[model samples]
Target: MSHTEQAMPRRAGQQGLWVLVAVAVSLALLAGCGDDGPTDLQPDAGTEPEVCGPSDVWCKDQTIDRLDLLTTVSTGEVREEGTTSGEFLTFVDSRAGGLSPTMSYSYLRFTPQGLTPVQIHDQESLGSTDWDLAVRRYTLRVNSGTSGPSCVSVANTPEGTTFASVTAVNAAMEFKTEAWFDTACTLIPDDSGLNGPLTQLGGFWAYTSCVQMTGRVFVIRLADGRHVKLEVTSYYEPSAQQVCNQTGSVPQPSGSGAIRIKWAFLP
Candidate 1:
């Protein structure tokens, strides 16, 4: 073949190779920017993630950059005891070193049927919006303010208002965040069992030496703006029920930290 003819064919082959490489580069870029890509890619700092789903419900607003450690924190097993009055009834074994000096919290998310346990126990737990509530023995915390960065908050009903009675969230009802500290940054203690520090659902259980349900119902506003009415039904198992009398002593004290709660979505 002539030299010019040979050079033309080689140039054509080189052009075809370049076209193939360009196509592959485009595909790789598309794949990297896809929705199912790795979570390591950081977005703008402090930028809130977009509201997800067709219903615009909960936002998977986990700030990957804010977390110092990416290790998976441990959690305990959760039990489903079925439903009660169109509400979900769940039993959480939150006995992670109950009353011990060093303890851990069990994180959980609310579901229509029951509570789904979320295993995130490290610094990443505070930055992730996957969990709605965290329980450590008697104390409880929601994902907001000092607790985390999701928009979860709570509003308490009247003194005698039952969970079933709270059909809708009134416009005047004030929503409060999970506050574990006061204005001076001092750690607020649950000394009175009434949550003097202004925690949203802190008063659900009262401790007068003996733990007992205060029968308080709270309407929790979830991250997606949906409301749920929740109440702590029992602190012990149903088989071994115990409550303090007029005095603060329990004659037959049942096993503690068997947290049982009943909750349902509100209108």
Candidate 2:
């Protein structure tokens, strides 16, 4: 072998050492993004499902787990009012849609069987609408009705993951979201964080509580990485007073707090 080839063995050996080191670092990833194990359920981010049958809402080649409470996010703040102000979130791509679009990917987490909380502007867990949307699209419905909202179903998209939507009736169904092979999302192989362009991939997966909407189309967007466009109406932010007016759905409508989490992959 040439001189360069002769020296390759040492370099390769060093890389092997690095791989081992990385494997033994801290097992941080083994834990969820927030903490890395099961802590206390205080509504950090938080139900289900119906219409096309809750069990039917899933990706064939992907797996996921999620939960949602029939809750609301009503911060007293004027800017964020009845929106994901300081409380919880409960909608998907109510932006623009058809009626029966296929989904892409998604994942969701929830308390065993009770109402949970959602922390707005939850910076610690890389929380944000876009990030939340990403996870929601990949995990749950575009417009879920764990509370009372209606019109939920998946939409048709060009290609990729679009959170399936379903109606809200009085059904308390257990559900999950999933995805399959997607190459378009390749640009963003590691979107759990700020890895690369939020693109769609041929392969995807997710799980969530429930989805509620009435669109029959979907759009796989390449903007800000991989985002699925559900065929539904726009997400309308409710007024603080309006949200507060509706009681029993959740306890506190307008409140702000930080979110801490610890999770592990469910079998």
Best by TM-score: 1
C-alpha RMSD of candidate 2: 20.8
Over 1-267, each residue of candidate 1 has an lDDT whose tens digit, in order, gives 899998998999999999999999999998888767666775654565334222221222222222122344445568777546667877877677545513346788987657888877646566678888877666667887766767788888888888778888899889887655555555565667544444578788677777767889988888876788888876766544344524554555566778888788885
Q: Looking at candidate 2, what is the lDDT of residue 183?
A: 37
Per-model TM-score on C-alpha atoms? 0.67, 0.18
User: Each candidate: how many clashes?
Assistant: 0, 63
Could you tell me how far off, in angstroms, the CA of residue 169 lies in candidate 1 after the best superposition?
1.2
Candidate 2 lDDT (Cα, whole model)? 0.27
Instruction: Output the lDDT of residue 12, model 1.
Output: 97
lDDT per residue for candidate 2 within 113-174, as digits (tens), equals 21122343212112122212223222223222220111232223333323333222112332
